[model samples]
Target: MSRGNRWARSLILLVILPHLCIEIYCSKPDPFAAKKKRMSEKVRQMFYHGYDNYMMHAFPHDELKPLTKTFTNSLSELGNLKLEHLSEKYNGSALTLIESLSSLAILGNHTEFEKGVLWLSENLTFDVDARVNLFECNIRVLGGLVSAHILATDSTNRLTKGTYKSQLLNLATELGERFLPAFNTPTGLPYAWINLKYGVMENETTETSTSGCGSLILEMGALSRLTGDPRFEFAALRALRKLWSMRSSLNLLGTILDVETGEWIEYSSGIGAGVDSFYEYVLKAHLLFGREEMWRMFQLAYIAVQKYFRYGTWYHDSDMRTGRATYWQLTSLQAFWPGLQVLVGDVTAANSSHREFYHVWQKFGLLPERYLLDHQMVHPTERYYPLRPELSESTFYLYQATKDPWYLEVGEAIVDSLNLHTRVEGGFASVRDVTTMELEDHQHSFFLSETCKYLFLLYDDSFLVNKNYVFTTEGHPLPILHSWHERLPEAYIPSNWTSIKGEEPKRASAMSMQICPASMHNCIHGNVQLESVCHIPDARDDHRCLSDEDCGVDSTSCRRRLCSMAGYCGQWRYH
Candidate 1:
């Protein structure tokens, strides 16, 4: 009796236990999978939110603050005296204008964008700065013109398409004509800089680095596409040949070079500021133009970056000749590396790098212009983060690729930190002290272009799902027309259009649409109040200014002030 009853019970228990295990574990989804999906959606939301706010409010409106006004007015005050070309003399102004215009175009701001284009038409010309340096001028005029042309013909804007086509084509011809003289060298590498009106320096050394040669693809290739001319593309391709020929045996490139002799000036390599974009452009040039050769070049360069320069935490520059590690500091420009990594299908690496970089931002409340690798300290002298979105940009791409929720959490944390620390009455400001988490009231143009654009895209990539959006070299999104019939020509279109094909559309044009939600404005409300004080040493006086007069004979006196003010002079003596 006992054997039969026990055997029946054991049989029942065995059958039930296996089914229970399957129900508890196998039948239920993996917890990690659920967590990853949630993280991915959050990342998407962060990008979309940031993108919408930027497109609606920030991009359409120029900084136009007192500080920016002062900067621009000072430049305008320089008049024609400051060398009208894109030389170092005018690089700052040209860069500023280019960033602004690029941001506007990305946001699809037709009215303001047309104004910017008209301003360029009236003020800038191939000949205005003809005597200016060649490469700088080329980047400014050729790059600027091609980028503007892309915006002008953007199918989304539809306000002034063909109006600029003739102008843009003529400008492309002029740039192509100007760049021809630089290609006369036997090595095919152009001089670092050229005069627009004149030819290359006969004795100019051909020792150009990757960037000097690599950056030409966007401008020249765009010009080729616009004008239906092959010469533009040929010139850029020649430069690529010269630079690629000089790659170190390791396939890495140095920082600087002689344009005529083809000798490297600085044989250091990394995916940082000076050298980062060279790698970026190789891949992008292929993406934009569908060039297999450029793609091959990118594959080689990217492999070198991954194998040699990349660390678990960051990318470091190495000696070009020895392949030995060199600098490991976080340069201001290195911020774009993660985003570029995401673009190249290296999402896991990109996510790791992004997390490390965001950790720096979390510690400082904003990323310093540069960070020391060993101590994880912000470079005291270079503490300004100019509203760049490289980390956020990477987060956007990672979310897009992996659909991870952690990236959304990262994006939200970034937005919260930015609002809490950087947002000012005028707009977002730069960093004052990375250690102290202080703010400096100077907003950069990329706040709209890359920063806000990435944020918005984090949330609403769906907006771009059907649209062919190609970003500028700086990461400003460019509209790719799906069909010629859907194209928006610049001429004869009003500020608002009723329909794309006379079907009585819902909105006038993409330019007039509001991308951001109203709640985002709440995020922008704050003043960059000076909440912390630090005393800077003054050698002029032995005694610190407790009541102002104690510091110096000529100091203005205050009878009684808070210790906070006295702390500025290290004079807080307790009675």
Candidate 2:
């Protein structure tokens, strides 16, 4: 080679290499980044102003209405009780007892805190109701236990350390034991609902929607940690694995399935209510368990969701097999997507998605529960906002990630909307008409556990940042970890921390389980306790010397049944 040729090649390599390095190391301005930032700031400002409004105009200065009186009286009464039995009816009787305890704890109300403990200690029971369903049972009991555990451990909470430790441990054990029935299915996927008392239903259909099967991990997984029982976590993991295994070759899961056969009962999918928590559980399971496999599965599933479902402003499920778009529009449950995105380091996308949803909120003081796909019109009949904080939850995440004042502004806006439309004489109304901005009188427990909590976090975040708070599937904060005390520099507190009331001890008797029927046949039942039976005829002929018709008993049923019993029965012959 000649010297001049060598010099030219070197010059070319030098220029190209440097340019490549710059491209690799530096990210370009995401066209959506600026928009997200501006929108977030606007939201934060709105939240601040709204919070002021709530404090001044909306919040009850005195107990005037029945609901207000009930709430105030409940709090005051809860503070004075002496906790003793494991079954106190009033102080720790309702499913909302944990939230009540938490609220008081957050306020540093020692009287309420002590009463809550007394109530929980005396009333805690692990019995499931004959009519109670499985999912509700788990949420009330396991959710209560976990929330109470957080309060017991929190230094700020007035409850003494180990005050409810033994009872909590026992509660964890019992709750873990109760979850076994849900995993008794052939496919290892839980039934949509189960009866607590009668065990599982025999001859019962093995059908379940995504929400029914996909929302178990948080409570069960937490139980596993608290009780040192792997079975609870294992059951949740098996459900996850079973569901994942049923995904189409394109790596997409459908909306519903026959739990027994693992067949696609409903092909349509959306990032909404019935299916939203499946994605949430994947990421959160990994976070809690530190399992690499969970992370890998989440990465694959998340990438597929983003690649196939995402349009400019919304996400819809595509065909599980072909990756073709099936639905397009906003869902009330889609409000949580942005928060999930923020968790996975896609702050830019999270910001954009949140802004679009915020626009929906602005158009209506609160976002409607659902929207149309092609028209961008709100679903008229479904126009009530359930007072959910999913969008606000995402806004809080965006704010924490960017430190942009916009998130605070969004918070202020949400606070304003709630105060303006939802604040009744009661604590907060359950739902509101997006069109009329009229308040609905019902108030759900989550208003305090999730919605108000997020709003509080957006404004303050001191509580959240001070401890590593992991939110449950229901958007309830759990297992607050004080890791920051060791790792974070003294001068900088993560803006995500905002102090709210500590979670209160769950009343034992408040927990309820559903009662389902028992079957003799070899079918997987809904409730966890029933043993599986294989009633489907075997593919292999016991009577060997038969004609083709006798031998040709459909293999599909046999295969499906086999798979259903085992949870993950490998592949299926659908045709």
Candidate 3:
């Protein structure tokens, strides 16, 4: 062991050990990337399995019956409260094809999207004798068309651009014209049901859900922008404005109302099916159209929902007039609220609600249609899990906002659950009951349009890179383009995209470039400090805080709180 020998050994150790560490660091499996690619391909296969089967057995039909390997013209059946008045003579409008259009683009199947668009342009029609729910038709059909039309006309999509006329736009306008007659009511609120061929059906139910008349602005507004006809936008705006006027003093809206009388029919309200999309549309409309009115309505409505409806991230139904708790239960549709909250920069609260929904998803291996929170059990009869996309949709949004690997894991879990329980030889089937994992025959069009699409986008969002788009309730992607707006506000900034600030002024956020409410209090005022998913009463006697000095850092996140303009302490995020 001389000096020369010791020197040689030390050099060997230094060089070899450094190389080994580098190799280990580089080669250690990146589980996130690997899982993402694997799950993405799995989702693609799932989509083609359903899409190909629908083409084989259910093409030109409304929905596929996977168990029977057949089709059902289910357009009239959806949202029909009593499951009555289904027409025997009504043929399909190629419902499955129309729904799958945006999905094709999402999966990067340009050729297939082009082929489907061509087929739909040449063959599909809304001219059949079918009584359809206004909300269902607008979201699934009109939203689908407008979304696909934008993709078709975009040069980046590799679509057959030259040959494409505004064919989809033309069809959308015609369908929109038919929708106009439904708005001819005494109160400006459209009828819940309308006959495609003959307009509003005789003695059609005067009752409509808040969402029925309130969620039309996105589709109809896009139509006006594309076709240069204001009737569609004007009618939708009129209905929305009228519906806003009908809200209770507490800023709550009921689930159902009489279109003819402009009165509340069922005053109990919550962020569930009938009223969920109404809240979503207003916030998104402001983003899409740069309309301050929509933003004001949404800000007030959102604050009210958080104040009265939320209980430690679990929202329950309440009397719209009184703000009294009515139904202490959870519906799968309410899962969308977390995703909507993300758009308003309430990621902390969004994360809290999303985790609860994910926990429920884990419990059932799927999210049941309804869960009785009071009993901590699935609802007795509303036990079905209808391949809903809300959870995955929120998962994607959360991932976009946080870039956390955990959301990708959630996406993986969701993809696994679908493949294990719902995949059939023909197509994906709905869960008739979560308790038994029993399969239902009906394959909802949204299973393709939203569920699979969001799952795919979760794993691979190249389409969303450098682009700003707001997704409709049905998961249709509507780009927030400058050309589509009637008037672009100076303060407006597109979601997820960076804005340029210069001598020419433009809108910006208090915290970020995004123009959403920056403070948690501004977003929603109830429990100002959102540190955890569950509420734990602070030991202090007075919970109110007048300034940032009065508040402390969040216990869970260690993030600072600020005095919101509402004069309450609220959570703040720096990035």
Candidate topping lDDT: 3
lDDT of 2 at 436: 73
**TM-scores, one per candidate:** 0.64, 0.66, 0.83
TM-score winner between 1 and 2, please give it: 2
Candidate 1 accuracy as TM-score? 0.64
Better of 2 and 3 by TM-score: 3
Best by TM-score: 3
Off by over 4 Å in 3: 1-31, 81-83, 161-165, 487-575
Candidate 2 structure quality by residue, lDDT tens digits, 156-264: 6447554554566576676567558867877788875444434565564467777667677778777766665667766776677778878877678888788778888
In model 3, the worst 10-residue window by lDDT is 13-22
Indicate the worst ten consecutive residues by lDDT in candidate 1: 13-22
lDDT of 2 at 409: 66
Task: Tell me how far the alpha carbon of residue 428 in candidate 2 is from the true structure, in angstroms, after superposition.
Answer: 1.8
lDDT of every model, 2 decimals? 0.54, 0.55, 0.78
Q: What shift in Å separates residue 35 of candidate 3 from its native position after superposition?
A: 2.0
What does candidate 3's lDDT look like per residue over 1-575, in tens digits?
22211222222211100111112233456557777888899999999999999999998888999989999888888877686767788878888889999999888888888888888888878888899988899999999999999999887877655475368887898899989999999988999888898998777889999999999999999888888788888789879988998999988999989999999989999999899999999988987887656766886787678667776557889999988789999999999987886666555567767888999999999999999999999999998998999999998876755555778889889999999999999899999999999999989999999999989988888777666788899989898877775642333423422322232332332212232232222322243422221111222222344445334334345446565666555666532
Q: For model 1, how does the per-residue alpha-carbon lDDT over 69-132 read when each residue is reduced to its tens digit?
A: 2232112122134433334333223334545555555444567667766665555555523333
